[model samples]
Target: MSQTIVALDCMGGDNAPGEIIKGGIEALKENKDVFLKMVGRQEDVNRELEKYDYDKTRVEVVNATEVIETGEPPVVAIRTKKDSSLVKCMYMVKHGECDALVSAGSTGATLVGGHVIVGRIKGVERPPLAPLIPTEKGGALLIDCGANVDAKPSNLVQFAQMGSIYMENICKVKNPKVGLVNIGAEEEKGNNLAKETYQLLSNLEGINFIGNIEAREIPEGKADVVVCDAFVGNVILKMYEGVGGVLLKKVKGTLMTSLKTKIGALLIKKELKETMKTFQMDQYGGAPLLGLKGLVVKTHGNSKAIEVKNSIIQCISFKEMNINDKISKKLAVKKEN
Candidate 1:
């Protein structure tokens, strides 16, 4: 069987080796073709592994001398912390030593290391961090979540193509609808960026260009791919998080307010938890810095083991889907214009 090797940055996320290590084992146990290379302090990794005696051959460890902190600048960490676990494992992906690199490290550092070390795919103008966000109808791919916040209309045009391909291929949304985010459904209702982007996207031939979608319509499944600058994308992502969190707390508080309600909560606790899973960003794993030469997934810094492991596996899906190549083809189409 071909090796689905994943180079894990063991020191990247909040849970570190503890949760990441356990999640890796679970992933390998469920899939025999999978292999993991845990990159971190060797002693610490091995000590954690001693607790579970699974298939030892499927897992290996590579020690790194330094660990990059979340607070450090991304460019500096990628350069100065060359021996850091995040950088080392990333290098492996760049050189094809591993199929993918998963890290819950600093976004800046990951972006810098990915571009400076691994590089971006040919014909990719600006690599966006595209993550799958679950919606009522499965999920939607939000590109340039934070990569190029201050993007140009041309950049947004490209994001529409990239996001379209991702939703079509990886997400399996055939002829996925594309919408440019605006203050309202009108084309002239937004700032210079949104208005110009709306015009550009309207003329773009590659995507299934749906009309503008307001932020209010996101969860209602108005469109599969919403193209915009990173600033707007980031704001939407944060707003979704804030709303989901507030709602969860409100429901819990309401349920615990009375004995009768508490009883109802107990009866529906499992269902509620399942419902929450659909909205949990962590459950969807980390966001992918799309358009790079190699796969680089940046998870939340506070991510646990499952999120880290799933992010690693998520790269496998990205590779399998040929997302980068699809984006490249779309870009080539745009270049002819």
Candidate 2:
């Protein structure tokens, strides 16, 4: 088996070097064909590495002197922080030193660095952040979660195309159904942008367009690929996460209300826990910024070891499937016709 090399930003997330290093070690244990280049302060990375027992040959520490904070402006930070872990990680993928780059740092910085450093695939108008959200049918790809806030109709068409490719190739959703986010299922039911996008997507070839889908039907898995501008998509994504967290807390509270309820909770604890795990966003890993020349995945800034580990492992499939090349070919063929 060929080895997949992933460059991870060790000092990017809320947990910083410790959790990131732990996740890398855990990923190494799970997949022997994976090699990781930890990018951050050499001393901090080495200090974390000493806490684990593993084959040191599979892991390399790349020194980065600075760290980009969440508060810093993305474009300014990426331009100014030449020695930052995030910038170095982006360069690693840009220069082909690694197959992919995974970071839990500033989302803005990651997105900006990805476009500025790694560049976008030829013929791709705008690269959108596509993330898999757990749904009734399995998982749905929410495109443009937070990339381009004000998108054009043509951009939506491209997002649908790239999103469809991702679902079919990466998520293994056969002939994935695509839907436009709107006020209603009717074709003429949205703002000027939505109406224009609906027409474009409906006439577009290759994608399985299913018309407009209401926000309420999203959780029921109305479509495998939900297309919308970043403003709307980001709102939906945040609401989903916020609601899921609150619901889980309420369930726990209810289970501990009284002695009888507590007993019932104990009886169904295993099954309930298993069911909850399916809805966890962390289990699905980070969102990939599609249409880029290389893979760039951004996890939550507050991500833990498990989320970090899964994010790194997710790159293995992305590399093996060659998603970036697939997107390039798809768009190139479309442009030719």
Candidate 3:
């Protein structure tokens, strides 16, 4: 844990090398143990790097001439764009040159590179994209948020197992409750996939599998790990974000509507801001593609400095905690049991 090296895609996000480089520098300044290998075009990355004042020895600029656009086909892009920032960063993680990769690039490209490049851990059917979602009690890890859209029941079962390990180690939620995302609370209420997954999870050892959780109950912090296929998980994630954004906007608008409310807002602005900070998604960093040989994290494509900084800082814990090794051991024991 002396130094955790993270390969960052500087040319992949909407903000590109500017914000991306800024985040990397911020992460270095924040975490004295982190060393960043920034990947992007030489001139672009160098230009951005000149603006930041940080330890010179801790930062390395890796040149990657090509850039992968979000519109490009992920599989094709990964194969063809050999010198793209995203692909180059993925390879660094795969080859053990870096402990992890952080990208605000194309989701499709990240997933594709993770599987096709970094590869999956053995005995893992499908690697899941698990992101911590804020809730009443704390945060819940939503597994398979945008990977494995057609995941089988077995995949969901693994998601629960992997997610439990993540919450326990990273989030420090001991014996985290795992819930199957479903329409009704009953075991027999969901479709074939949910019903089957529920049965499998109910009997799974080492995880605290709760019964079905309705969508409404998610915000209530009903479960620490919410398991579902990518399609359902993606829909729920998007809806959760959209609703949260609208609600925050509405509250801010209401606070400024009248002089009276504005005065009241001033009285409570500090407390309210502190409370709201807990619910911000960027604070949690990017979603980690679990069950891979090397860690691959995907942030929003429009990510700014804060999210990128947090994402790089997050890699230190993943490496120091030895998450991939823990996952391999957990799955291996489960198979034996």
Give lDDT tens digits, candidate 1, residues 161-255: 88887777766799999888888998889899988888888877867998889888877778888777888888988888899999899999999
lDDT of 2 at 174: 93
Compute the lDDT of residue 114 as modeled in candidate 3: 95
Whole-model Cα lDDT of every candidate shown, in order: 0.82, 0.92, 0.91
Model 1 lDDT-worst window of ten: 308-317
Weakest 10 consecutive residues, lDDT, candidate 3?
276-285
Any runs in candidate 1 off by more than 4 Å, and if so which? none
Score residue 112 of candidate 2 by CA lDDT: 97
lDDT of 2 by residue, 153-193 (tens): 99999999999988888889999999999998898899999
Task: Score every model by TM-score.
Answer: 0.94, 0.96, 0.95
Clashing pairs in 3: none
Q: For model 3, what is the alpha-carbon lDDT of residue 271?
A: 99
Score residue 323 of candidate 2 by CA lDDT. 86
- Please list the residue runs of candidate 3 whose C-alpha ends up more than 4 Å from where it truly belongs after superposition: 265-270
Per-residue lDDT value at 183 in model 1: 84
Error of 2 at 39 (Å): 0.4
Residue 22 local lDDT, model 3: 90
Give the C-alpha miss distance for residue 221 in model 2, angstroms.
1.3
**Cα RMSDs, all models:** 1.7, 1.3, 1.6
